[model samples]
Target: MPIERLADLANPATTPRIVFKVGSALLFGAGGVPDREWLASLVAEIAAAHARGQQVIIVSSGAIALGSARLGFAKGGRGSLADAQASAAVGQIALAGLWSDLLATHGIVAAQLLLTLEDLEDRRRYLNASATLGRLLQAGAVPVINENDSVATQEIRFGDNDRLAARVAQAASAQAVVLLSDVDGLYDRHPSEPGASLLEQVKGVTADVHAMASGTSGSGMGSGGMTSKLQAAEIATRAGITLAIANGTHASPLARALGEEIGTLFTPVRRDGARKAWLGGRLRMKGLLVVDDGCARALARGGSLLASGIVEVEGDFRRGDPVIVRDQAGGQLAQGLSEYDAAEIDRIRGARSNQQEELLGYAPRSAVIHRDQLVLL
Candidate 1:
C-alpha cells in the first residue's frame, strides 16, 4: 500500500488505538512553559478523537521547559545534569496540571503516568504498565505519559520522549504514532537552509533519512532533533506502527496529520505483537543465560523454560537485566531479562524454589524464568 493510504487507514476514525508525542519545542515557545492557547486547541483535537471512540494516549515533553522557567534559567543555559533533573522535578506538577485542566474543559478525563526506562525494561513492570494503559483506554480515559525525570539517573533515562513515545505505541498496539515537532515534517535537507524540500511520504525509514538528520541544535528546552525524530520513526515503523512527523506549532496538528492533509508520513514495514515488539527493540541488554537442549526444544514449541532446563548463568546480571536465552549448543532461542540474579539462578537450577533452603540454606520465589517474562524469538 502507498504510505499515505497506510496513514489514512491508521487514523483515529479508522483505527482504535493511537499514540501522540508532543515535543518540547512545539509545546513551549522560545520561552519556557506551555503555550496555553496552543495546549487548549491540542486538547480539543484529542477530545474530538475521544468522542469518535478512538483510544488516545499522549506522550508529552515539557517538564524541563516548565522547570527551566520555574527555576529562572535561560533557555540555553549550560546547566549540569543535576540542574536538569531538578528542573524536571519542579516542572512535572505544572505540566500535569496543564493537561488536567485543559482536558477537563473538554469533558475528558486525563490521567498522568510517570515512567522510567526501568519500568519498561522489567517484564513484570512492563506488563503492569501495559495493562494500566489498556484499562485507561477501555475506560475512555486518555493517559498522558512522561519520563519520570525527577528520579531517573542518566543510566536509566530514556534521554528523550520521542523514543519513549515509540515504546508507548508498541505497548498500546497503537496503529500510529504522531510526533509533533517544531518542524512541519522531514526535509531533504536542513529545513533552516534555503531550498530544502519537505518529503510528504516515506515508504520506510532508510539510510538517507538517517544521513539527512542532524543532532539537537542546542535549543536547550529538550534534547531531541531531526535525528532523534528519525530514530523514533524507525522504532515505531519496525514495531508495525505507522508514524507521522508534523509541526505542532499549528494548533490541532494531530487532527490534521490524521486526516492525511498535513505532515510527513512514514509507513510501517511490518507489525508484531506488542510485548514481542518491546522485547525485540530494547536499547541495551545486561546479561546472558545459557540453557540446555530440552529448554531449546520447549521454547521452539512455544513452551516456557522451566528451572530444570537451565545449564549455566554468566555475568552479574540482576533480576531485570536483559539476558540472552541461549541453548546448550550456543544457539539463541530467545532474549529475556532474568527474574533472579545469577547467584540465585545458579543455586535454584535443576530444583524447585521449595527445595532451595533444604539444599542451599535459602529460598526465593519460584520460577527463575516466568512464562510472562519470556519472549520467544
Candidate 2:
C-alpha cells in the first residue's frame, strides 16, 4: 500500500506507536521556566492516545535549560561542556519531577530514561534499553527519554535530540516520529527569505529536499538546527518510520501534528522483517566481517554466512558479539551475532566447513553466522 496522505497521518486513530520530540522552546515558556499550560495540554493529548491503546514516548530536550536557571546561569547562554553536564544533572531531576507530576494529574505514569550513545550502540545495551521502554508502554506508562548530557563528551554526545529521537523511533519500531520544534515545517527556502513557502509533504529526502533545510538552529532555547532535523528525517524514513516536523509551541502539539496536516511529512518505505528491522537501526556492532560477492548473493537469498565466504574479520570481538557483514568492496550486507570469536574467524577465513576440525581444535555446530541470527540489509 502507498503512504497515507496528510489528513490520514494526523488522525491519531491511524498510528499505533508515536514518538514525540519536544524541544526546549516548547518545554520552557518565555520566562525560561517549565510551561505547565503547554505541558498539561500535551499530557492530555497523550492520555487520549493512551485511552485508545496508542503507545506514546517522549524524547524531551529541556534539562540544560532548566538546569542553567537552577544553577544561576544566564538563559540561552553558552557554557563549557563540564558546565553543561552539571546543569543537566541538576535539571534532569527537576524535568523528571515536572513530567511525573503533570502526567499524574491525567492519571498517567511517567518513566524517565537517561541514555548515552553507548547504550544504543552496544548490542546488549540496545536490547536492554528497548526492552525497558517496551515494558513501560505495556504497563500504560510513558517513557520520557533524554540524552545523558551529564556524562557525555563531544565524541559521545548526540549534540541534539533530533537524531537521538530518530534512533528511539527505530529501536521502539514506532510508526511515526513527530519532531515538535519552533518552526511549523520545512520550507522551499529559508523562512527568512522572501517568498519562501512550506513544503507540505516530502516524498523523498533527495539533495534538493535537503537543500530546502536551513542551517540556522531554530531558537536559542534549543541546540538542534533544521539540518539535524533533516538528518533525523533521513534516518527515520529509511527505517520504515514516517517523520513529521511541526510547530510545538501550542497546546497538544502531538495531536495537532497527527491531525492537522500542517507539518511537513516524510514518507517511509515498507517495514522489513523483524531481523531486518533490528539490523537496520542505529545499532553499534562490535566488529566487521568482510565477505566476497558470492557470500553477499547467498545472504540475499537467505543463506547463512559460511567460513569459506569470509574475506576478513576486523576488530577484536568475542562470540555472541554483534558484527557487521560487509562485501569486499566495503559495502554493508548484513549484521548478526557471530558464532565464532575474532581469533577463531581470523584462522577460518576462506576455509571450507569440512576443514574446520583440522584447522581448529573443534568443528563448529553451525555456520559462522546462522541464518536465524543474520539480518540482511
Model 2 lDDT tens row, 100-186: 998888899999999998888666787888889889888989999999999988887678899899888878878888898887899
> Relative to the true structure, how large is the alpha-carbon lDDT of every model?
0.77, 0.82
Q: After superposing candidate 2 on the true structure, give the runs of residues whose Cα lies further than 4 Å from its correct spot.
A: 1-3, 9-13, 29-32, 35-41, 47-53, 73-81, 104-107, 117-140, 152-160, 170-173, 184-240, 249-256, 273-276, 328-330, 354-361, 364-366
Q: On residues 1-377, what C-alpha lDDT tens digit does candidate 1 reach at each position?
A: 33355346344565678888887777787568468888888888888878877799999988877887888876432277777777888888999988999999988888999999988876678888989998998888899999988888778888888889988887777788888887778889888889999888887777777787778733556678888888788778877888888877776776665564567888877665666678765755677777778778887787766667778877888887777788877765677657777887787677755676776666555556665666654
lDDT of 1: 0.77
Report residue 366 deviation for candidate 1 (angstroms).
22
Instruction: After the best TM-score superposition of candidate 1, give how far the Cα of residue 142 lies from its true spot, in angstroms.
Output: 1.0
